[model samples]
Target: MSLLAHGNSILEVEVTNISTHGVWLFAHGEELFMSYDDFPWFREVAVKSIVNVEEQSPDHFYWPDLDVDLTREIIKHPERFPLKSKSR
Candidate 1:
Protein backbone atom coordinates (compact mmCIF):
# COMPACT_ATOMS: atom_id res chain seq x y z
CA MET A 1 0.00 0.00 0.00
CA SER A 2 1.07 3.56 -0.64
CA LEU A 3 2.07 5.78 2.29
CA LEU A 4 -0.40 8.49 1.22
CA ALA A 5 -3.22 6.02 1.75
CA HIS A 6 -2.46 5.79 5.50
CA GLY A 7 -4.27 9.09 6.27
CA ASN A 8 -2.39 10.21 9.40
CA SER A 9 0.64 12.44 8.70
CA ILE A 10 2.79 11.08 11.54
CA LEU A 11 1.39 7.60 11.25
CA GLU A 12 2.50 7.66 7.66
CA VAL A 13 5.95 6.54 8.73
CA GLU A 14 6.39 3.30 6.83
CA VAL A 15 7.51 0.41 8.97
CA THR A 16 9.92 -1.87 7.22
CA ASN A 17 11.08 -3.82 10.28
CA ILE A 18 10.61 -3.71 14.03
CA SER A 19 13.07 -4.89 16.63
CA THR A 20 13.95 -4.30 20.26
CA HIS A 21 15.98 -1.28 19.22
CA GLY A 22 13.53 0.59 17.01
CA VAL A 23 11.81 0.65 13.60
CA TRP A 24 13.21 0.88 10.15
CA LEU A 25 11.76 3.13 7.45
CA PHE A 26 12.06 2.80 3.73
CA ALA A 27 11.88 6.30 2.32
CA HIS A 28 12.96 7.44 -1.09
CA GLY A 29 15.62 4.96 -2.27
CA GLU A 30 17.62 4.74 0.95
CA GLU A 31 16.76 2.80 4.07
CA LEU A 32 16.72 4.91 7.25
CA PHE A 33 17.22 3.16 10.54
CA MET A 34 15.87 5.16 13.50
CA SER A 35 17.31 3.72 16.67
CA TYR A 36 16.23 4.46 20.22
CA ASP A 37 19.80 5.56 20.93
CA ASP A 38 19.23 8.72 18.93
CA PHE A 39 15.44 8.87 19.11
CA PRO A 40 14.51 8.19 22.72
CA TRP A 41 10.83 8.85 22.05
CA PHE A 42 10.48 5.55 20.23
CA ARG A 43 12.53 3.58 22.69
CA GLU A 44 9.52 2.12 24.48
CA VAL A 45 6.87 2.76 21.89
CA ALA A 46 4.65 -0.06 20.78
CA VAL A 47 4.77 -1.51 17.30
CA LYS A 48 1.70 0.52 16.36
CA SER A 49 3.43 3.88 16.84
CA ILE A 50 4.42 3.92 13.18
CA VAL A 51 1.21 4.12 11.20
CA ASN A 52 2.35 4.85 7.67
CA VAL A 53 4.95 6.56 5.53
CA GLU A 54 4.19 8.65 2.46
CA GLU A 55 6.58 10.03 -0.03
CA GLN A 56 5.83 13.74 -0.26
CA SER A 57 8.29 13.84 -3.11
CA PRO A 58 11.51 12.16 -4.09
CA ASP A 59 13.36 13.38 -1.00
CA HIS A 60 10.80 13.90 1.75
CA PHE A 61 8.96 11.63 4.20
CA TYR A 62 5.93 12.51 6.31
CA TRP A 63 5.12 10.84 9.64
CA PRO A 64 1.54 11.55 10.70
CA ASP A 65 1.74 10.26 14.24
CA LEU A 66 4.61 12.01 16.01
CA ASP A 67 4.63 14.78 13.42
CA VAL A 68 8.20 13.79 12.68
CA ASP A 69 9.44 14.59 9.23
CA LEU A 70 12.73 14.02 7.40
CA THR A 71 14.41 14.39 4.02
CA ARG A 72 16.39 11.86 2.09
CA GLU A 73 19.29 14.24 1.59
CA ILE A 74 19.62 14.75 5.33
CA ILE A 75 19.67 11.06 6.08
CA LYS A 76 22.18 10.35 3.38
CA HIS A 77 24.42 13.27 4.28
CA PRO A 78 24.11 14.12 7.96
CA GLU A 79 27.74 15.10 8.26
CA ARG A 80 27.10 18.28 6.27
CA PHE A 81 25.23 19.68 9.28
CA PRO A 82 27.32 20.10 12.38
CA LEU A 83 25.98 18.74 15.66
CA LYS A 84 26.19 21.94 17.70
CA SER A 85 23.80 24.23 19.48
CA LYS A 86 22.87 27.44 17.62
CA SER A 87 23.19 29.53 20.79
CA ARG A 88 26.92 29.54 20.40
Candidate 2:
Protein backbone atom coordinates (compact mmCIF):
# COMPACT_ATOMS: atom_id res chain seq x y z
CA MET A 1 0.00 0.00 0.00
CA SER A 2 1.27 3.43 -0.88
CA LEU A 3 0.79 6.14 1.67
CA LEU A 4 -0.64 9.37 0.28
CA ALA A 5 1.93 11.44 2.08
CA HIS A 6 5.50 11.54 3.17
CA GLY A 7 6.54 10.75 6.74
CA ASN A 8 5.59 13.38 9.31
CA SER A 9 8.62 15.58 9.22
CA ILE A 10 9.20 19.22 8.40
CA LEU A 11 11.30 20.13 5.36
CA GLU A 12 13.18 23.37 5.25
CA VAL A 13 14.17 25.44 2.21
CA GLU A 14 17.35 27.39 2.71
CA VAL A 15 20.15 29.16 0.88
CA THR A 16 23.18 26.99 1.21
CA ASN A 17 25.65 29.15 -0.66
CA ILE A 18 25.96 32.46 -2.47
CA SER A 19 28.53 33.57 -5.02
CA THR A 20 29.08 36.34 -7.55
CA HIS A 21 27.40 34.19 -10.19
CA GLY A 22 24.44 32.86 -8.22
CA VAL A 23 23.09 31.22 -5.12
CA TRP A 24 22.64 27.59 -4.15
CA LEU A 25 19.40 26.52 -2.51
CA PHE A 26 18.79 23.34 -0.64
CA ALA A 27 15.21 22.11 -0.50
CA HIS A 28 13.41 18.80 -0.39
CA GLY A 29 16.64 16.86 -0.71
CA GLU A 30 17.69 18.72 -3.84
CA GLU A 31 20.19 21.47 -4.49
CA LEU A 32 19.19 24.15 -7.04
CA PHE A 33 21.19 26.89 -8.66
CA MET A 34 19.72 30.32 -9.34
CA SER A 35 21.91 32.68 -11.31
CA TYR A 36 22.04 36.45 -11.18
CA ASP A 37 21.71 36.48 -14.97
CA ASP A 38 18.17 35.24 -14.60
CA PHE A 39 17.46 36.42 -11.08
CA PRO A 40 18.81 39.92 -11.21
CA TRP A 41 16.98 41.16 -8.13
CA PHE A 42 19.40 39.21 -6.03
CA ARG A 43 22.43 40.98 -7.45
CA GLU A 44 24.18 43.31 -5.02
CA VAL A 45 21.82 42.31 -2.21
CA ALA A 46 23.01 41.76 1.32
CA VAL A 47 23.58 38.22 2.54
CA LYS A 48 20.83 38.69 5.11
CA SER A 49 18.37 39.63 2.38
CA ILE A 50 19.43 36.82 0.08
CA VAL A 51 19.12 34.14 2.70
CA ASN A 52 15.67 35.28 3.79
CA VAL A 53 13.75 32.87 1.62
CA GLU A 54 10.50 31.10 2.40
CA GLU A 55 8.79 28.15 0.85
CA GLN A 56 5.14 29.08 0.66
CA SER A 57 4.24 25.70 -0.80
CA PRO A 58 5.98 22.59 -2.03
CA ASP A 59 6.83 24.19 -5.36
CA HIS A 60 6.47 27.86 -4.58
CA PHE A 61 9.08 30.06 -2.92
CA TYR A 62 9.05 33.61 -1.69
CA TRP A 63 11.73 36.05 -0.65
CA PRO A 64 10.03 38.57 1.58
CA ASP A 65 13.08 40.80 1.83
CA LEU A 66 13.41 40.99 -1.94
CA ASP A 67 9.65 41.06 -2.58
CA VAL A 68 10.04 38.15 -5.00
CA ASP A 69 8.03 35.01 -5.50
CA LEU A 70 9.22 32.17 -7.71
CA THR A 71 8.25 28.64 -8.57
CA ARG A 72 10.51 25.63 -8.95
CA GLU A 73 9.83 25.50 -12.66
CA ILE A 74 10.84 29.12 -13.09
CA ILE A 75 14.02 28.63 -11.17
CA LYS A 76 15.03 25.48 -12.97
CA HIS A 77 14.19 26.60 -16.47
CA PRO A 78 14.48 30.33 -16.66
CA GLU A 79 15.24 30.27 -20.38
CA ARG A 80 11.77 28.94 -21.11
CA PHE A 81 10.30 32.16 -19.76
CA PRO A 82 12.00 35.28 -20.98
CA LEU A 83 11.00 38.95 -20.72
CA LYS A 84 12.05 39.90 -17.25
CA SER A 85 11.11 43.22 -15.73
CA LYS A 86 13.74 45.90 -16.32
CA SER A 87 16.16 46.07 -13.42
CA ARG A 88 16.65 49.49 -11.92
Candidate 3:
Protein backbone atom coordinates (compact mmCIF):
# COMPACT_ATOMS: atom_id res chain seq x y z
CA MET A 1 0.00 0.00 0.00
CA SER A 2 1.07 3.60 -0.62
CA LEU A 3 0.30 6.69 1.36
CA LEU A 4 -0.97 9.74 -0.41
CA ALA A 5 -0.12 13.34 0.37
CA HIS A 6 -3.10 15.34 1.58
CA GLY A 7 -4.14 18.91 2.45
CA ASN A 8 -2.49 22.07 1.19
CA SER A 9 0.82 21.87 -0.64
CA ILE A 10 3.79 22.01 1.68
CA LEU A 11 6.61 24.49 1.37
CA GLU A 12 9.75 22.94 -0.09
CA VAL A 13 12.23 24.56 2.27
CA GLU A 14 13.78 23.10 5.42
CA VAL A 15 16.91 22.64 7.46
CA THR A 16 18.10 19.27 6.27
CA ASN A 17 21.10 18.98 8.61
CA ILE A 18 23.10 20.75 11.28
CA SER A 19 26.70 19.89 11.85
CA THR A 20 29.60 21.12 13.98
CA HIS A 21 30.65 23.28 11.08
CA GLY A 22 27.40 24.61 9.70
CA VAL A 23 23.79 24.10 8.67
CA TRP A 24 22.31 22.61 5.51
CA LEU A 25 19.12 23.86 3.92
CA PHE A 26 17.04 22.16 1.27
CA ALA A 27 14.90 24.51 -0.73
CA HIS A 28 13.15 24.36 -4.06
CA GLY A 29 14.92 21.13 -5.05
CA GLU A 30 18.33 22.59 -4.21
CA GLU A 31 20.62 21.90 -1.29
CA LEU A 32 22.41 24.88 0.21
CA PHE A 33 24.98 25.07 2.96
CA MET A 34 25.61 27.92 5.39
CA SER A 35 28.86 27.74 7.27
CA TYR A 36 28.88 29.01 10.84
CA ASP A 37 31.84 31.20 10.01
CA ASP A 38 29.69 33.06 7.53
CA PHE A 39 26.20 32.70 8.92
CA PRO A 40 26.93 32.99 12.62
CA TRP A 41 23.32 33.65 13.57
CA PHE A 42 22.70 29.90 13.72
CA ARG A 43 25.94 28.86 15.33
CA GLU A 44 24.78 28.76 18.94
CA VAL A 45 21.01 28.43 18.63
CA ALA A 46 19.01 25.52 20.03
CA VAL A 47 18.12 22.67 17.70
CA LYS A 48 14.40 23.28 18.10
CA SER A 49 14.81 26.89 17.10
CA ILE A 50 16.93 26.02 14.11
CA VAL A 51 14.43 23.56 12.73
CA ASN A 52 11.54 26.00 12.88
CA VAL A 53 11.87 27.41 9.42
CA GLU A 54 9.34 28.82 6.99
CA GLU A 55 9.44 29.74 3.36
CA GLN A 56 7.88 33.18 3.17
CA SER A 57 8.26 33.34 -0.60
CA PRO A 58 10.17 31.69 -3.42
CA ASP A 59 13.82 31.33 -2.35
CA HIS A 60 13.19 33.25 0.88
CA PHE A 61 13.27 31.62 4.32
CA TYR A 62 12.45 32.86 7.81
CA TRP A 63 13.15 31.39 11.22
CA PRO A 64 10.62 32.77 13.66
CA ASP A 65 12.33 31.27 16.67
CA LEU A 66 15.57 32.99 15.80
CA ASP A 67 14.11 35.96 13.94
CA VAL A 68 16.58 35.37 11.13
CA ASP A 69 15.75 35.63 7.48
CA LEU A 70 17.73 34.61 4.43
CA THR A 71 17.46 33.87 0.75
CA ARG A 72 18.98 31.28 -1.56
CA GLU A 73 21.41 33.75 -3.02
CA ILE A 74 22.69 34.83 0.41
CA ILE A 75 23.25 31.27 1.53
CA LYS A 76 25.04 30.36 -1.68
CA HIS A 77 27.16 33.49 -1.89
CA PRO A 78 27.94 35.09 1.45
CA GLU A 79 30.93 36.90 0.05
CA ARG A 80 28.69 38.99 -2.18
CA PHE A 81 26.99 40.40 0.91
CA PRO A 82 29.71 41.17 3.40
CA LEU A 83 28.08 42.64 6.47
CA LYS A 84 28.32 40.40 9.48
CA SER A 85 26.69 40.90 12.87
CA LYS A 86 27.82 39.06 15.97
CA SER A 87 25.51 36.15 16.76
CA ARG A 88 23.94 36.37 20.16
**Alpha-carbon lDDT, every model:** 0.57, 0.82, 0.85
Candidate 1: segments with Cα more than 4 A from true spot: 1-13, 77-88
Count clashing residue pairs in model 2: 0
Report the C-alpha displacement of residue 64, candidate 1, in angstroms.
Answer: 0.6
Compose the digit string of candidate 3's lDDT tens values, residues 1-88: 1112585556577788999999998877788999999999999889989888888777888889888989889899999999887988
lDDT of 2 by residue, 2-69 (tens): 11236654547888999989998888788899998898888888899988888887878888988988
Could you tell me how far off, in angstroms, the CA of residue 19 lies in candidate 3 after the best superposition?
0.4
* Model 1 Cα lDDT, one tens digit per residue, 1-88: 1633457543333568878876678654556876655445455545565645556766686656555566766555546643522220
Error of 1 at 17 (Å): 0.5
How does model 1 fare in lDDT?
0.57
Worst 10 residues of 1 by lDDT: 79-88
Considering lDDT, which of the candidate structures 1 and 3 is the better prediction for this target? 3
Q: Name every residue pair that clashes in candidate 3.
A: none
Best TM-score among the predictions, by candidate number: 3
User: TM-score for each prediction?
Assistant: 0.58, 0.83, 0.87
What is the alpha-carbon lDDT for the whole of candidate 2? 0.82
Model 2, stretches more than 4 Å misplaced?
1-11
